[model samples]
Target: MNKKSNAVLRLIGILLLTIAFCVLGYLNAKNIKLGLDLNGGVSITYQTVEENPTAEQMSDTVYKLQMKAQSYSTEAQVYQEGKNRINIDIPGATDANEILAELGEPGTLQFADEDGNVLLTGDDVKTATAGMTNQNNNREYVIELHFTEAGATKFAEATKNNVGKRIFIIYNNEVISSPNVKEAITGGQASISPIESYEQAQKIASTIRIGALPVSLTELRSNVIGATLGAEAISTSLQAAAIGIALVMLFMLCVYRIPGLAASLALFMYVGLEMVLMQAFEVTLTLPGIAGIILSIGMAVDANVIIFTRIKEEIGAGNSVEKAIKSGFEKALSAILDGNITTLIAAAVLYIRGSGTVKGFATTLAIGIIISLITALFVTRGLLTAFFALGATNPKLYGIKKETKVINFIGFRRIAYSISSLVIIVGFIFLAMNKKNTGDIFNYDLDFKGGSSTTITFDKDLSMMEIDSEVIPLFTAATGGNASTQAAKVAGTNEVIIKTRTMTTEERTKLYDSLQEKFSISEDKIVTENISGAVSTEMKKDAVWALLIAIFCMLIYIWIRFTDIKFASASVMALSHDVLITVTFYAVLRWAVGSNFIACILTIVGYSINATIVIFDRIRENLHNGSKKKGLEYVVNEAISSTVTRSINTSLTTFISVFVLYIFGVSSIRDFTLPLMVGIVAGAWSSVCIAGPLWFDFVILSKRKKEQLSKK
Candidate 1:
C-alpha cells in the first residue's frame, strides 16, 4: 500500500484557514442588516368603511393631516400601510395625546342653527357620505347627504311647495351626489343613497365609513426601528458568525491537523464567495440566512472529510504520495459534487417556490452550496496542489490511516433493494391516503389563492377569541360559504391567521360583500389579491428548470473531472431518483391533505442533491484506485461500503439541524422546512442504495459496445 499521502499536514492547513475566516466574518457582521421578518414593526389597520372613498379624497385628507401632525412634531413618517390604514411610524414617540393637537385641522364640521343664520362652525356640511345597511338583504351602501338635519328640514319645507327643486350632495367641497326631495320631511331621518350598482354602493359605503382622519395620529407603536437596535442586531449576528467560524476552524485544526488547515482555507474561500454572491443576489441577511451559513460551513468540511477518507484508504492499499493525492481527490470529487448539487437543487427549488423569509434562507443556502462546491473542488485542490508542489510530505496532515476495505457492498445489494422498494411503497401509501381523503390532491397557499388579509387596529384590545367570533363568519359567508360552513382545519393553528380554503373570484366577490356587511369595511379595505394562472405556471416551470440546470451543470462537472461518462451518469441518475422520490413525498402529502405541495417538492429537490454528491465521491475514489481494474462492480461496491457511515452521519447531522428548524421555527416557515427534513433522508438513501448500484448496468453496456467495436 502507498503510504506517501500527507493527511496530517492537509488537516492542519484546513484548521488554520478556518480560523482566518472566523475572524473576518465576525468583524464584518456589523454591516449586515436584519430583514423585516426578524424585527417586526407596527401593522396598523383602519376600520374599513362600507364605501370606498376616492383615493384622491383619502390622499388629500391624509396629506393635510400629515402636514399638520408634522408641524406639531417632526418625528413621524406616514405611509399608506394598506387599503384601509395610514401607517405613522414615529421613532421614539408612542404617546397618542402628544400628536392630538394636529388632529381636527381644517375642521369641516358645522354646529348649525335651525333658522339658517351664521352659526358656530367652520363650514356647513355641504356633503357627507354615510354608510347604511339594507333592512331586507342586509346589504350596505354609501349614502351622500347634501345637508345637515337643520338644512334638511329647511330644504324639505322649501321642496314641499316646489317639488322639482334639486338638492345637491357634496363631500369635501365637491358635489358628488344629488337627490331631489320627494316630499317635505319634519324629522332628521332623510337618507340619500348614491349607488349605480351594488358593487359601486359597497365601494362608496366603504369610503364613507373610513371617514375623515380627525387630527393626525399621535404616534402609537411609533419609532419601531431605532438606529441603535439595527446596529445591535448587525453587531450581534456578525459576532456570532465570527465566533462560530473560529470555533469550527479551531476544532478542525486540532482534530485533523495539516489537512484541517487545507480544509480551513477551502472553507474560507467558500465563505468569501458566499458573501459576494449573496450581496449580488440581493438576498436580505436575516437570522435564518445566518443559520444557513452555519450549516454550509459544516457541509464544506464534509467535502474535505470525504477526500481525506479516500486518501487514507489509498495509503492503506500502499499507494505513493503523488498517487494518493491524485486518486483521493479524483475519488472524492464525485461525492463532493453530488452532495453540493443536491443542496443546490433544494435551494433553487426553495428560492423559486418560497416567498418572503423562506426565500431569504433558500437564497443563502443556494449561494452557500455553489460557493462550497467551488471551494471543495477548486480551492481545496489548489491548496493541496500547492502543498504537494512544496515537497512537504507528511501522512498525518491528510489524516490517511492504513485500513483494509472489507465487506463487499455489492453482496448487500439485496438489502438496498429491499429499502428502496419499501420507501417507494410507503411513499405511495401516503399518496393514496392523501388522495382518499382530500379532493384536490394539493393545497394552495394564500399567495396563489388570492387571499384577503386585514389587520384592523381598534380603540379596544380584543383577543383572538373575540376576533374569530366576529371576523371569520363574516368573511367566510361573504366568500359565498354559508355562515355556518366548515373550513378545512389547519394544523396547530389558532385564530391568529384565519384563512379560508381556495375560493373562486365570484366567491371572493360574494365574500367581499358579506365582509362589508359584517365588518362595516370600506370597499378599498376588502383587498382580494387575484393570482394569475400564468404566473403560477411560470413559477412551476422556473422551479423545475432550476433543478434541471443544476443537475446538468453537475453532470458536466463530473464528466469533466473524472473523465468518465459513467460516473457522471450515475451521479445525476441518483440525484434525479432522489428528486423523484422527494416529489413523490410531496404528492403523497398533497393528496393526503390538500395545495402548497410545490413548496415541499422544491425543498426536497435541493435536499436530495447532497446525497447524490456523497455517493459520487465514493465512486470516483474507487475508480481512481482501480482505474485499470476488470471488476468495476467490486470497486463500486468498495466505494459505497467505505463512505456509507460518513454519508449517513452527515445526513443525520443535517437532519437534526433541519428538525430543529422544522419544530421551533416560525409557523409561517414550517411548510418550507418540513419537506427538507424528509428530503434529507430520502436523498441520503438514494445516493448510497440507489445511485451506487445502478452504475453497473451503464458500465456493462458500455463495455459490451466497446468490445463489439473492437471486433469490427
Candidate 2:
C-alpha cells in the first residue's frame, strides 16, 4: 500500500475499533454486575444456633449459602461474618422478606415414607442440580440427586423395598415432593422428575443444597437497601467521573497540545474498552470498584504524561517529532512498566486473598490496570502516530520541554525525613489518645464491630442526606452521642435500615419514640436486631497476610527488575510511609473504618509504589546514563528534579478525580474518596521526597563502607 493508503487504512481501522468497542460496551452494559453498595440489595446475616461452631461447619454453611444466594443474583456474595455468622449480600434485590422466605430455614433434609418411616437424611446427599430431561417427547425439569457412598447403599435398599410406594423428600419438616419409586435402582444417583418449570426445579435444587450446611442458623439481621439509592449513587458517580475526566482531558490538551488531545481520545477508548471487558468477564462493580476505575484513569493519564514529557524533552533537544516520539516512548517505558506492574502485583494479591467487597475492588482495579496499559502503551501511541501522519506534528504543537535544573533533594533529605517522622509520630499519639478515649485505636464502623440494626418503613422515601441530617441526630441525641450510625435506604420502598453500636432496651425504646414522633412511623413498621460484623476477625487476619504477601512480591519484583536491593528497600519504605501516613489521617480524623478501609489502604499502596517506581526508574536510568560518574548525590538529585513535573501532574490528576468523587458522592463514598485523596498527596510526597533520598543514603553509606574496606 502507498503511504497515503496506509494512513487512510490506519485511520479507518481506528474508527472501526472505536465503533466496535462502543457497540459491544453498549450491548453488554446490562450484563455488568453491580454490587450491594451500588445496586441496593438485601444483606442478610445468619447466626449459627450451635455454640462455637467449627471452622469446617462455618465453611460448609458459607458454601451452601453462596449457592443458594446465586439464585437471587449470580453476583451474590456469601461469606462468614465474625465467628458464628454467615452474611449474604444480593445486589439489585428489593424484597428482603421474599428473599428470606426463598432462602428457607437451615433445617435438615430427610427422605421419609408416607407411613412416617424415616429413610435417609441430607448427610447422604453429595450434590443436587436442576436440569431438563426428555420425557414423552417433551422437556421436563428434574432435580438430579447424587448420594454419598453410605447413603447410596441405604437408598438403594430402601428403593428396592419401597418399589411402587411413595417416598417424600422432606425439608425443614415440610414435604417438598413425594415421588413413587418406579423400580429398584442400584445406582447412587436418582432423579425426581415431572416437576414444574425450571424455576421450580431450581427452587428444589436450592432447598436440597441448603441441607449441605452442617449447622442450623437463625436470622440475625436482614437489611433491604433501596434500588433507587443505588441508582442515585451510580448516577452521581458517573456525573462526577464525567466532570473529573473532562477536566483532566482539558488540562492534558492545554498542556501537551496534540499529544494531550490524542491521550484524551485514548482515555475515552480506555473507558469504553474497560466497560466492555468488565461485562465480558462478568466482573462485579461495587461503589469502591467505581473508585478503582476512576483512580486507574488517573494512572492512565500519568503514564501518558510521563511519555509526553519525555517526548517534549527530546524535542527541546532539537530532535524531529518522529524521533522524539520514538525516544520519548523508549525513555518512559521503564517508569510506566515498573509503576503499573507494582500496582498490578498488589491488585493480584488482593484478588487472591481478599473477600467480598475487597475482591470486588481488586477486580475493578486489576481490570483497570490491564486496560490502562493497553490504552497508554498502544492506543495512545497509535493515535499520536495517526495524528503525526495527518500532518499535525509541529514540534511547537507538542510543546517544548525546557531543561530542568537539578534540585538538591539529597541535601534536603533530613527535612523530608523529619517531617515524615513527625507526622507518623503524631499519628501514633493520636492513636493512643483515641484508644484511651474510645477504647479503640481507630473508629470502627458496623463492618468491623457488631451493631444493632434497625429497619424502619417510613411514610415516604428519604434521601441519604435526610437520613444523615435528620434521622441520625435522633439516635445520637437519644444515645448521648455515644452511638455511631450508618443507614441505607431500601430499594423500591420508603424503608431505611440504620445500624449503630449495640443498643440497650432503654436506648431502643427512646429511639422508637423519637422515630414515632419525628417520622410518625408505627412500631409494626420497625424491626431491630443485633448484627455481627460483616468483616470477621478471621477475614481481617487474611487481609493482613495479603498485604504482607503483596509487599513481599513487590520487593522481589523491584529487586529483580532494578537489580538493586536498596531500590526495592527504599520503595518498600516509601510504600510503608504512605500507608502509615494514610492511617494517621484516618486516626486523627476518626473516619469510620469500614470494609472500604482495606481497599483504601491497598489503593494507596498501589499509588505509592507507582509514584516510587517513577522516581526510582529515573534514578536507575541516570545512574547508568553517565550521571553515575558525578557520584550518587548528583545522580539522585538530578533524577528527582527531572521527574518532579511528571510526579506532580500525575498526582494532581489523580487527586482531582478523587476530590470530585468526595464532592459528589454519598457519605459512604465520601469516606472512601476522602482518605484516597489524602493518600494520593501522601504517595506523591513520599515518591518525590522520601523514596529517592532513602536510596541516596543507602548508596552513600555503601560507598563509605567500600572506601573504608579499601584502606584496610
lDDT of each: 0.53, 0.84
- Lowest lDDT block of 10, candidate 2: 223-232
Best by TM-score: 2
Listed per candidate, the RMSD to the true structure in angstroms reads 19.7, 8.2
Off by over 4 Å in 1: 1-36, 39-277, 285-291, 314-366, 373-400, 448-452, 460-535, 552-569, 587-630, 701-712
Tens-place lDDT per residue, model 2, 345-399, is: 8889987766555566677788888888888888888888877887877899999
- lDDT winner: 2
Cand. 2 Cα-lDDT: 0.84
Supply every candidate's count of residue pairs whose N, Cα or C atoms clash at under 3 angstroms: 92, 6
TM-scores for every candidate against the unseen true structure: 0.53, 0.80
